[model samples]
Target: MRKVVGIFFLLFSLSGVTEVKDAHSASHTSVLLQSAYESVEPGRSFNIAFTITPKEGWYTYWENPGDSGAKNIFEWTVPEGVTVSAAAYEAPKRIPYTGLMTYGYKRPSTVLFTVDIMSNYTAKSLPISLEAEWLVCEEECIPQYGSFKLNIPVEKAIPNEAAADTIASFSTHQPEISWWDSRLIINDTSSALTIEMSEEEIKDYTEAYFFPKEDGVFTYSAPQTVVGMAEGLVLNAERSNSLNKPEQVTGILFLKTAKGDHQYFYLAPTLETPTIPKLSQMEDPIEMQSFPLWQALLFAFLGGALLNLMPCVFPVLSLKAFAFVSAGSLSKADRHKEGWAYTSGILASFLAIAVVLIALRSGGDALGWGFQLQEPRFVGLMVIILTLVAMSLAGIFNIQTGFEGAGQTLTQKSGAKGAFFTGVLATLVATPCTVPLMAPAIGYALTQDSITLTITLMMLGLGLASPFLLLSYSDTLASKMPRPGPWMEKVKQGLSFPMILTALWLATVYGDQTGQLVHLFAFVTFVAFLIWLREQMSSPLKRILILGVTLAFSAWFLGVSEKAPDRALSDQPSTSNVWTEQAVSNLRAEGKPVFVYFTADWCITCKVNEKVALQRTETEDMFKRNAIVVLKSDETAGFTPDTLKVLKKYGRAGIPLYLYYPKDGSEARLLPSVITIDILKEYIEGKGV
Candidate 1:
């Protein structure tokens, strides 16, 4: 439905709509104005949150003031250099009282608004003023007001720890685009509003509900239906017939996962119908990691360290290198600061991966490393982001956002994003390492419990982070380095080309996996439009909206796309035959030498074999010359009951399985799951394994 923005934007925009609210002590509540920033810098923006704390046993109202309570109001009196965004309120808990339903806070609460400080302000300190009014209720209602002013000092606009934590606590309840392939069934004849997530992700949640911030869309009193299974979940809410059917839909989805309850803000992902691609093309790569903890740790660390010098991580490395050099000189303290920051960023990124891995393991998702590149849409999104970053690096448009800023201007102090933030993102983009090389290590970790998995992943992170951290902190490195200057600019700009190349590589991988580029190209255009829109947005509020929406879309799209199938690769024509006991026995009975192989769509090892050996023109020619029939059995979407029986009979149940039966009726030979082209050629040439 084309609805008003969620409670977040509406809450901030309500500044002038209500009568002035001033400080006052009432029967059950009090009001006060506070800022999240300790001080404000010119040209920067900061948050000023309203603390509408009530006495014990009392509650305050939501922005919509659902059903009965009056909405809180605010008026601002600020310094001439200051401007404020419309107000924003935290998500409220649903409270049921004496035959009425209300959405509000029971304990001390906060509502926030943005304040922008003009760049021209020369004042050493500024007076900020705010007045507010709210209603507090238990069985009865009480009106309250407060007037507060604070002289905030003129200093670097650093964020305050407590204020950020407070905002995050309340904001966690807001709905966000955390799911991909999500849709709002707008024109459906069914009375319920339906939402769908990928099968792999939805099964994790047991209960869900959509809360419409605006009125007239959904009946607050109507029940919600939640259907979840191995594939995904579908949530339904009754449509309000009194209101016209919304062309689009927006609301918060309250979800309960293993981590507990959360409000994931759902902005419309796309109006198009989400396609259900086939299952994964390769057997999961990470599923093979079954080493003991010590071995897993050692391998993980080695794998991580190798990533630093890998071609895929080149772009990130260049950014960090330039940032380090531009600093020119660093004292002992400076080295310590830089080392810790970069290390922290890497570890955080690794932990995030662990969380997803653990959750998917618990939920029964058969995904491995590098599988993310299989999704055309996801690869396309990465292309968009990378292209934007390249443009920014080449001076096409300046990106003030954090991702691009991590490598930002090398001259900027401590590299705004520096090594730390870049390390996190870089590690994620390091998809190449998750395959054949690291597969055994990662796979072993995946099979173990969460604790072992987490420990193993941390080792990997430490290995990847060690080089940068050590380089920054070591005094000897400074003496070995060339002095920083204009030469650095040439290197910085040159690095953009490699990033663009990486983007191209991603696009090629997308085409290989999906065999389609329509969606990929479309997403690039969408990203360009948003970036252009951001450039044209002179107003801070406009910029915030554009940024928030774009980010939400990116996050949701990537998460969903990662789970999509590889249609082109998994469903492609190949020279191998599908395996079945009857088919194999019949061929052998016909006096034909038969070659049998087993594979699954989700097996990365299977995919490599397909490309390198089975699909080879020479291999097919040899099969024909020798009158050998090639057979293949697919287990991409997991094994069916019949396939399971076949697997068990073969003395092993996993892929890639290879068996050779000679025409002379000699016993069949079983080959290794991972076979080399040379070895396969030897077998085809009558050499026994």
Candidate 2:
């Protein structure tokens, strides 16, 4: 009966969607699967798109989702004589929150995969099976399982007009190698590289991203850029602070261009060159190896330390420690028991998080942190929780759980439980705090063996819970607390300020994730509901009713609502253009100066550059004065054909790249991924209009 009631309440609480399980849909729900194919021959690669439309608010994972979530499972049941390789993915955007990360498509995103069918395979009917597993979500995420079996015929003659049109469209969008200046000059002494190009290719390109083929060489986000004389660009790549000089610097060069993205690959053999320029060259492609294990563990430890400082953990940890310290008459042994209990709580929470993450990863989520909070409804729920905590601390209500004979109320008798629960709550709240200190550690942990992974997570938990543990286990610490007095009330009320502050921060985050209007509406509703709940009798039935109301509101606000707003470029220019190497080359060939910026939508360095350099008034003015074209190539989706071309041409693949081209048809000059006002001025002055 209770289960039935819960189910009924869940069904009744839903908004913005309806579920139908008809006889036909019992075996398979109404799923829209769109498939398109292209041919890959010399100078061209085929682009294919397999779109699976879920019943809205459903998703699939990327290659990695840190901590919790399932990986998107796909099986190919192909027809005879047809060989297919894994589809290359466009670089993905990173979303970080708190301590957890997940990577996947947020909206009704189409998964684009490519196929290289030999010319001989044309005109043949291809039998294929597309078996996929994904997570369909609207609050409570559900795993979806299905397989698509279809026989698509291949044409022997030239592709039909409609097919040709579709193929052409996909091909145009496919990633390809673009124009790169063939000359590369590397200064090992100063750790700099310069490439000369036409001045007209880029105007005042900034915010460049570079993907170094070799790891531990150049740091991911620290290249200094300078525009040199004539049509050339110079890059001063600082050697990794932790290591000596690398044998060679290789990767993709992503720059900004007017036509959208200006992406190129640069693979130049390490050469000792003086002041004169060196001719650039490309080499056979090499695949990168995964990061080693010990390093991953170390990263996890560091990440764990940083997690303690996160908004969620900070409040909870501080409160828990204060609670322990306030528990005056407790013995040392009693305090130790509380410490163990708190540890147990934290460990249990970690286990649950791990299970959820692993399940979602198995189902195919991507590498984003705190993605569960992406919905406004969830954020609303968190706000409600924080508000309740603040109200409770302010003595707005009394919560008693039996134990009347023991003369201890629920909040006093279970200080240990409170501390432990605090740990769990901290984990729940800190999902949006992904930072550089935590990413590599969590990222590496995700790819590790479960034992190692669990240990790493536990270490993180320990780090976050350390303060509470120490406080709980130390009677001496408890003795240090001020004797129970009027000052205690002042401190309690003061602590509520943090809660209020946290609530405000969450509301703002929620607003940023959704629209300001949605946040405002949600806040008004939440405040009104809280006031009403406070007015109602605090009876058992009323408490249950309030819980139901809270859950219902959360579901509606987070689960049934639209996706979060993209706050990446709230202050940036138009996003219509995607830079490509071919486009950059074409602009340069057209005798136009070009400014190329290579960056990932998720890269902090890239974001900073976008704000300070490219978007600056002076930069824009200089670009206009020089009649320079602006281009932005994104590497967040990995390497596209256009991205690959740019990477190969420039002999690079890492991000935060910048390049410049004069109006001449000569090679492009490599600029530093990092830039300053003086650097920009020098480049503009060197290449006179």
Candidate 3:
């Protein structure tokens, strides 16, 4: 008769009727609410337990459900002035499902909560309600929910031995605060948790696993490698690509003793500063030997020389060429002075940039080459400077230094000072273009000492200035130049078009960085007004004042522009097919050849490669023919640590990084910084690898 009545009550609860009961049963699971005390006492705290039992072969999730699954959620409805603490979960078991790992319980689990009663309570009875939800999973998942209600008399607390015993039985499953000192060391690719204990303390432990309370801390499916040391044990695991480097490593460490007993300990370990491993220590796919100092310096020089041919540098080079043309009539000694001055300017700029890069890196910033262009303010400033240079080149107005007597033209000056500033301009414009050997050289330099970095950058600057420097020294080469004529002015105006185009490109980059066009429009308008003021104002003092005010307003506008939203790529592909670590892994697992290219709006070489090779019809057809999955990692708005990790793994510090992963699970091959259509076809055809 009692069993029949319990069944009727279960059925009645399932019918959604509100009733004062201690248990609720669903199809796949059953939930029972039990309190340590039968009656509530004012101003006292008591514990309540929710025992969730899943049917055979089914399971429920813990707070962090590993790779995939939702944890149990509880919502309470109690009288005012009563407080309820958050539910505390038992240490979960590692449940392996196919290729994924999850954290949950296969059998019964108890979650405890503490309820505090107010001293001013005057009620005859205490009514408590709970809405509980959980996901039960086996081969498939089913979401289950239950509504439970209980009523207790508001009198002196009376201990319930049965309820206390039930709760005590599961107390062993709860994790105690860890006694061992633990520290977590994180790196670019992996993290290590080290627990300091005597060997005798862990002699009986056979295996260990950690379940982090935070999601995206480590790869859930990746195997945790345990290494035993004289001091203690260390568990090393792959770092998740989405890891944000939490302040503390909080988790539950589950240990299985040799006696088949499970011991759980709660850990909140201190996080040590992360250190990137030396390139020589990296595993396969990134297993290349470390770059020699000589090789790095040589590559920097060669790459810097090649940078002259990049599109972005062409405009600035043309200005230098015009200076050379005007210098043709000067004495050879004067020309030599100009050459040395230009070289000095290039060297100084390179050293200054390198110094800042080193300083920032020492301060724990993961910055790279051309990092300044990633700043919208810096990009906006470039746009303004370039626009001014373009106007000067177009002969819109000659910049008269009051010291130069107000009649001298900037181009015709061709003095050492003019050439020096021209060299500075060239270096500034050339930063975004990474020629063939520059990536590795820059990457290696960044990992080296300050002295090595400075020397390497100086070598690069020297190489960039070499061609003009040699030309200036050789009288024969200077004589080969055409004499100054009216056509020089035409050529100058034609060169202005490239400068304008470069400014437009930078403006586009600024827009992408800020996600707003209004600021850019206002800045451009200010530039136009400056041009008009220069043409209209005759007094030098008035022109200077107007230019200063306009510059101030432009700076203000840039400061107030809205920052771009963070763009995180989804695991699945969208219409644009942005790159994500998971997406690449999934594509490769499907036996498809994957092509990934890293780019940025500030990177001119990347844009040129896209226009000339990757975007070509033949390249598209080749990709389709090979069933290639193309993924793009664009770091225009800002650089992500994940993207930086991948770049550094391939021995690169900046973009135009291309990789081709074959369908046969072979090693991924790194492509060149600059790729042509034939090069893409050769790689896609498996001939280049």
Candidate 4:
């Protein structure tokens, strides 16, 4: 039957019949074109409507057919001086079939068009033609077309009462542009359109749904949750996986008032910034808080223990190891004291950081773990401290207290004070590396109370300080350490290189943040000059004066470098586009796969992943072959609110986030924090679990 109907329409379309006809019926539908006036005067406007009646149990589509249908098409041929406006549609009913929701007319529907006749005196008759095409569906879909022609005598206007009455009957069905105050609020995962209405206006409505004119605005199959507010109604809809941030939301809102009475209104609301809720308040799909509090603490402790292996923290741990080797000659009691002092240092430092984070958040700063590194001044201070430590270990300068019995350099001292400061330095450098389990633990901790945050962080610090503390306390562990000897000096000098490398990395972060390489160059040169002066001068008083001057100059330089330049002028990667919520949506709408990686210069793990997986030739080739759009969001400088919202949406508080959106409109897959080539390829190929 479907094939026969298709063949019949195909034959009729090719027949090229030029005879006048006002109505045609075939394929379970009837179409007719009628004018409001039988005759019209020049310079006056008239209404023409195309009335479509689908047979029982069948339907035809509206301008924006939801989910899976095409809209009706119309082509008009009129006189040269005449103007015809596009068709306007009435509000459509929600038609559900075969588990898919669609918008169309199940009964008779009219699409109205306006035509203006020229003012100049013309011929006695005006001929008009229309080629109409539409799709009608019952259990199957069939294409239908009609050729419509009509002639009207050009004379003073004469009303066609029947036609005028037909058009008037459906006029109230058309949606009116709403005058109610409304706004669209969008976050990473969902969107809500809020409309202000009086209590009287909403009292009768029991249900409501928004039908967006634009495709991909919302998931048509997803249920819309509506909440009644004191001022109005908020229709919360699940955002389509492939959608981008819309400039304005244009749609028809259908309200079911009193079951039989339905109201439709048009809405075009502008986007407004939404107030992001606390992490605990969000209904995150990833179930970030699924694990118990004990599990989170365990994760934090293990993550911190693993952080000792990171490049940024290893140099400081190496220094502590050297101190442990030297402690072999010291009394067991002194070693125990040193271990306790170091533990205290680690716990105190973590507590201090927790306090500061809590205070800043209470003041409404949207910060996360490792947020300190985002500040240029803080990065500058780390660079200076690391550089000085490197120079001291390299024997360029000695950090002496200048008291009678305090002649030993700081790094060479095996006392409790030196060990304590080493633990503090270790904690400082460890912030930039986010290892496995660390992101979820910290994300959970930050959402907790102050006391919980402090305790979780203390557990992490305990893990970091465990190895050296155990060595100091246990005789067996102490015996395993190499004895201090002349060779220790060469080993110390070798360790200086790692400190130098760490310092250089931090300097790069500084440059990336401040966009001022000249300042870094000058600071390095100044430090070199100070090192030279210390070696050349023998007078203690002059040396003290030089040290004071260096301190003052360093302070001034760090203060001056805190002012960052405009980010637009900063250097960024040329190969990838900057990540934005809108750009990602637009690309997805174009049916292109997208790979977006969130990174930062301060994040060592992100840099490692980029060098090992993202920057490889095979990865580039795969991307090019697949026509994938790659975007990079650098948070080294600072995170935009949208970026932060995205992070929170994925249950993270920091970067090294990798997301792969498939071209087939599947939910975006979150890649591993530490990605290898095989892992990335697997995710891109839809083979990941």
> How well is each residue in 147-184 modelled by candidate 3, as lDDT tens digits?
67777777988877778766786787889899999988
lDDT of 2 at 500: 74
Best by TM-score: 4
Worst 10 residues of 4 by lDDT: 401-410
RMSD to native, candidate 2: 28.8
RMSD in angstroms, candidate 4? Answer: 17.4
Name model 1 segments beyond 4 Å from true: 1-291, 309-311, 320-336, 370-380, 401-416, 435-437, 508-516, 536-539, 548-689
lDDT of 4 by residue, 372-431 (tens): 899898898888888877877777876542110111232324377777777888898888
By lDDT, who's the top model here? 3
Residue 45 in candidate 1 has what lDDT?
A: 84
- Please say which candidate is ahead in lDDT: 1 or 3: 3
* lDDT comparison, 2 vs 4, better candidate: 4
- Which candidate would rank higher by lDDT, 1 or 4? 4
- Over 512-628, each residue of candidate 1 has an lDDT whose tens digit, in order, gives 545555666576667767877888889999988998988887776555453336347557676236677778777877889998876644344565677888888878888888899
Give me the displacement of residue 256 in model 4, in angstroms. 38
Higher-TM-score candidate of 1 and 4: 4
Candidate 1, residue 354: lDDT: 84
RMSD of 1: 30.3
Cα TM-score per model? 0.44, 0.44, 0.57, 0.58
Candidate 2 lDDT: 0.52
Model 4 global lDDT (CA atoms, 0 to 1): 0.76
Kindly report which residue pairs in candidate 4 clash with one another: none
